[model samples]
Target: MHLNRRHFLGTGIAASALLTAPTVWGQAKPKVVVIGGGAGGATAARYLAKDSGGAIEVTLVEANPVYTTCFFSNLYLGGFRDFESLQHNYDKLAGGGVTVINDMATGVDRAAKTVTLAGGQVLPYDRLVLSPGIDFKDGSVPGWSLDAAEKMPHAYKAGPQTQLLKKMVEEMPEGGVFAMIAPPNPYRCPPGPYERISMIAHVLKQKNPTAKIIVADPKEKFSKQALFEEGWNKHYAGMVEWIGPDFGGGKVEVRPDAMEVVIDGEVTKVDCCNVIPGQMAGKIAALAGVTDDSGWAPVDPATMKAKADENVWVLGDSSAQGDMPKSGFSANSQAKVAAMTIRGELTGSKTFPAKYSNTCWSLIAPDDGVKVGASYEPTPEKIASVESFISETGEDAALRKATYEESLGWYAGITADMFG
Candidate 1:
């Protein structure tokens, strides 16, 4: 079945309603330290506190007091949503019994089961959950690094980068070129780069109709390729060009200072550049010694337990789980399973089999949305997709509008699920 808004919301709420655990007595509560405050960590931390009912002490360690969701951030570029709408706070999580710490976790002494924060606090955890999301691989993009982001933003992480990219787009010279260097495979949000292209095209179409968009993608094909291509042609005709590796799209370098792009040794001056480089699990996971050489933490398909350590669980964009895309929905689904397993292990609560589902919605134009999703089950090798669905090319406008409406409901429901 499709993992629509209603189904997603129902499953999440049902998971929380499973059972109230017996409170602990005459003993210190088992502590769970959750790193990162995105969909995965936030939901995991909240669920552990809510269902365990004082049996498990859940502490969430996030650098930022308020989280700006990477999901739907492209819509902000398209002017479909305001920047403030993307930001969420930990006030509700704290009210829900989660110890929300606003500090950076700089070190993890896994052998001692302690996380050292930059503020000089060492938090002990019976279980450590890492959902720290993606960090760019240094030197992944030649001539571009974190320092260059000020000139050519990689709005992949949202917040200031998102705002900067939007500003650059809005301030572009008339009929100017907007170039994007897309990431390689296995990146967070498979269709993200393309959706962002569509949203940027939407903005350019309205503000600077003659502006051009060029995408330098390493991959030959992408998720929802047909759907996005159809939307681009129908809505932003003659305004977009896609250069794949077949055309030297992979051989790319940027001069952020000069605002120039080198594609296949051919130089092109661009008004704005968005460089999305290769990515890996956030640094904290590697510091915890759970991530493999691939720079991603591998987890058991059944429980999201880190393959390198029994006490560590990896979720969201950081985990090298199979089949499921690194999406907010996927992270949220994995968190529920991890929360349930942790509760059962720590407090003797009833545990259920892990069933994961995810849906990724991309807005191509106003009221024009497309999605790809699947339901997943764990096998010996990996978490495999059991069923899948996608919005087809040439879908009716009303259906696309309904799909967009569904995404709005999902955003409201998911943020509530994460924060409250």
Candidate 2:
């Protein structure tokens, strides 16, 4: 899709709705500080500012000036999209009344209700929204550390690491081996690693047909396992190999310097390796003392409010809300409910019960796209899935093409909903 300033302006205007009329404030406006500017925080910051109509002060603290979305970064690896297309700036957000600060949040004081930045600035807020995404667990993957990522890229965060992985894949030997160590359960984007494998296979099919791809997955079953397996067989048969727990995939170790992977007590030299380590909530959340021993913050399903502190809210992958996959779609859906609730609390506006929905689309090959989605409603216990749908295995090419096109539209729509 073509993007221009006018298109973004139009989309931004269309998404904006005034939730409450301009109110005369007796004192200073209620301050809202949002950390992380991905799907959840950016949408929440934008909506809170757009809907509240200057009634709430929304300051978005993000470490990066330009955000590269992890949602469609796989398409970039597959040669389906350019790296520039995956990037977005916050200029539009700044112009839309959000105070966009390009600085890292080093500390959060819950009792003081303030955030300290690496630049030595302290920001006070009446309400705080933490959507800081994920961080890798130390020593989760033996012999692999953040420093070792230079040799074996995770490419999970979708920035420099992604580019490095893509470069490595493109420059592989004609018939070299490429191995991937898939993360454990409850990681970001359940289908993400598999989608990446599909993209890598697509590239290998064109440039290096003799090349082989091996995946060591710890999970017994993954999201859309049957569909991915079917696609691998159909589009890139005999080129991909999957090792599950029954085959000792769970017992794995990697040596970045030697470029070797030990699977089930067998060492294999690989030309390239993708090591996705275990994950936890972003460090800032733990610093704020909202995250539990599980390495995720528990929140109220209805309002996305942190159960430990009502004044703080958590969203997206960092949240331990049940039944929702940790995808960009889920984060955006949760942000809307959280934004509406915050607006009501701060501006005395009308509020509605939270209803959330999400759909994740994965491209198997050129026009062969499949999807899985569900609608969710908050119960007293957790966010429960109400209804769900998925693309069938025997779907026609036309239908799969339509699914791919639908995913394209969703990409455009969601990024606009996010950055605009």
Model 2 residue 357 distance off true place after TM-score fit, in angstroms: 0.6
User: How high is the CA lDDT of each candidate model?
Assistant: 0.93, 0.93
RMSD per candidate (Å) reads 8.9, 8.0
Sequence-dependent TM-score of model 2: 0.94
lDDT score, candidate 2, position 225:
90
- Number of clashing residue pairs, candidate 1: 0
Clashes of each: 0, 0
User: Residue 307: error of model 2 in Å?
Assistant: 0.7
Candidate 1 per-residue lDDT, tens place, 240-278, comes to 999999999999999999989999999999999999999
- The deviation in Å at residue 102 for candidate 2 is 0.2
Worst 10 residues of 2 by lDDT: 18-27
Which residue runs of candidate 1 sit more than 4 Å off their true CA positions? 1-27
Task: Give a tens-digit lDDT track for model 2, residues 346-383.
Answer: 88999999999999999999999999999999998899
